[model samples]
Target: MIRNKKEYKQYLKRDRLALEIYNDGIINKLKNLFFPNPIWTFQKRMRKLEYYTNCKNYGLYKLYIYYLKYRYRKISIKLNFSIPINVFGPGLSIVHYGTIVINFTSRVGANCRMHACVNIGASGGEVQGPQLGDNVYIAPGAKIYGNISIPNNTAIGANAVVNKSFSEENTIIAGIPAKVIGKVDIKKIIKYV
Candidate 1:
């Protein structure tokens, strides 16, 4: 489906407003007090905007990102690496991004998603992270760092870890150590718009 120009403008406007609210209230205040610089502010604002943009329409967001990537090649390159936005799927809901890293060795399945401040990196400094399966959704501020195998139809709750393997499907993984909490249907995981 083609999202119209008007719709795109509305999305961008709403997005920027929401970001400004967050930044003015939380981010900028902390950033100014701790690390006072324009570069950090630029990166922070870009990440937050990128998060909202990702949760919007893919084609529209892609064009916007392409423009920014062209405008600021150096910043865009580093942003792409520092924050792993679409590590799982296109319809991923990203908001308020921060030090998020999705490992290159790991492979995430279709219909899978994640939110802001998520780190899917290697564990033990040797064994890599889990290979995520289809319909697996993770929440905000979550960290999944370890050698594991996540099956299809699983939901890793906010700030949880799956440091083990699940050969079966339809499960809920949560907590610091990370374990199966409950079962969930795969169909419930995919719903765009």
Candidate 2:
């Protein structure tokens, strides 16, 4: 359903759905609120759905949701060239969509928001991948390759290419090979609408 308001509210009526959404929001917000970086509002929105869903165990939830996400992502990648996906909880949200190829070893923190045409994979068969922190925001058309660690609350600008690890907070990164454009405020982003 791509996570519209009506769908979220309807889904939240269930006990488990409601609980899960809250936890998701809490986890995502932690990085946004405390971490020294900016996060994506879309991710926060996904978390609210988790809270509304009332998910209990993260492990089981991750497995179930990830499987579904992987399926959806694969299909969307093949057809639409656009992934209007709503990824909740954990695990599967990291599922690659379109030409977005995520390496098997890539570890993503809670509440990351990714868009279509993103490629997060290994560099030169290194086998190692990115270790992304909570509430990271990657705009469309970004490519993050190699064994990199993107710290909490960082925002990668649209069409940016990231090849190295970055830990500084509130940075707005952009360009081919992604340079720090500036810093961003996660709270301000979360407060968005």
Backbone collisions counted per model: 0, 23
lDDT of 1: 0.58
lDDT of 2 by residue, 1-193 (tens): 2235554454333312212333357766684466512112223333453443344326666666665555544544443333233323232232223455456577765455666678777799698877787667777788988988888778888889899888798788889878888989854543321
Please state every model's RMSD to the true fold in angstroms.
9.4, 11.7
Candidate 1 — which residues are off by over 4 angstroms? 1-96
Off by over 4 Å in 2: 1-99, 190-193
For residues 138-167, what per-residue lDDT tens digits would candidate 1 score against the true structure? 787677767777887787888886666777
C-alpha lDDT (0 to 100) for residue 55 of candidate 1: 54
TM-score of 1: 0.54
lDDT of each: 0.58, 0.57
RMSD of 1: 9.4
Worst 10 residues of 1 by lDDT: 84-93
Q: What is the TM-score of each candidate against the true structure?
A: 0.54, 0.54
Residue 5 displacement in candidate 1 (angstroms): 25
